[model samples]
Target: MPLFRRRRSATPVPAPGPTPPPPSRRSTEELAAAEAHLSDFARSRPGVEAFIEPRTAVTDTTVVFVAASGEWTRRRVRSPQQAHALARALGVPAYDAGVVGYPQRMREWTRRRAEEDKRRLDGG
Candidate 1:
């Protein structure tokens, strides 16, 4: 090797094989769980609004339901597209949580719940 010239180390490169199909984000068990939760919410809560959260790098899409009383529930969904479809199928208006912030009613409900819990703990 000449001065100022670096020698390259030998390394074996593995041959590439056929790429596997992308893994599915939604599983059957998860879908079933979501359906059950949604069904219960619909039967119990009248006029529930849906909010669809889009997928991120680490998390899958999810659908949240907000009842008139501010009670809320969420479950994993197949994708953002499916979340919208689910809202339509459920006959509820759907908003994108990523685009618009979470509903005001939801925050209010959470606050009320927290306050109630605190009072109960204090025996008030």
Candidate 2:
């Protein structure tokens, strides 16, 4: 026999709480809004092209519409297929961003915008 016997606890240990649900995806309204925005972009910009960006750990699959002027917009899409379909519907040529890569005009446009922003901020 042991010199000292351990005493049992009067109360039972509590079980772990239930697991929380996973985060929900974008809603129908949100998807519609995204589509509308894309349509609007296509209508307003002359010579717009769609580029599909693959999904990443941080972001969902997205489509980027770049105009001839280099102005662009990006929005999350359900999948690459949907992006291509959207491009077709918009009557704009689509390309895989990973394959051909983004156009140089887009970078130049971004740079010009940044300069314009700086000038405005400085009241120049």
Candidate 3:
């Protein structure tokens, strides 16, 4: 070892950068618009039922439309009121799945369709 020579350390030093800002919360109008858009999509699709799923996030609640065959479309809204409004505009019955649970008819239809598809795929 040479005298007055500096030893290099194996540890790496981290470089500092500016912290990112938190995500902005969606406004009520924005949420309502999203709900409307989703409802429109669902209504346009044949045999779809409009359903709402409540959420605790600041982004607002979610609105989903479950088709008779179990296919679904979803979007976020400001509140349940906005969801209902969108449902009415779409002319479909809107419901909270958490409270009412899934409709029996829709479930049965989906099951039958799945079984049929499986059988076809299996060539049985």
Cα error, candidate 2, residue 2 (Å): 33
Error of 2 at 45 (Å): 1.2
Model 2, 29-82: lDDT tens digits are: 887899899999999999999999998767888999999999999998888999
lDDT of 3 by residue, 22-81 (tens): 453777687657766785677667767677887654444777777766666678766688
lDDT by residue for model 1 (27-124), tens:
79979889778868867898798888876667677889998888999888787787787777878788888788787889999999999999999999
Quality of model 1 by C-alpha lDDT:
0.83
Instruction: Indicate the residue-level lDDT of 109 in model 2.
Output: 98
Ranking by lDDT: 2, 1, 3
Regarding TM-score, does 2 or 3 come out ahead?
2
Residue 120 accuracy (lDDT) in model 2? 100
Best by lDDT: 2
Clashing pairs for predicted structure model 3, backbone only: none
Clashes of each: 0, 0, 0
lDDT of 3 at 26: 77
Q: So what's the TM-score on candidate 2?
A: 0.79
Candidate 2 colliding pairs = none
Q: What overall lDDT goes with each candidate model?
A: 0.83, 0.91, 0.73
Model 1 lDDT-worst window of ten: 18-27
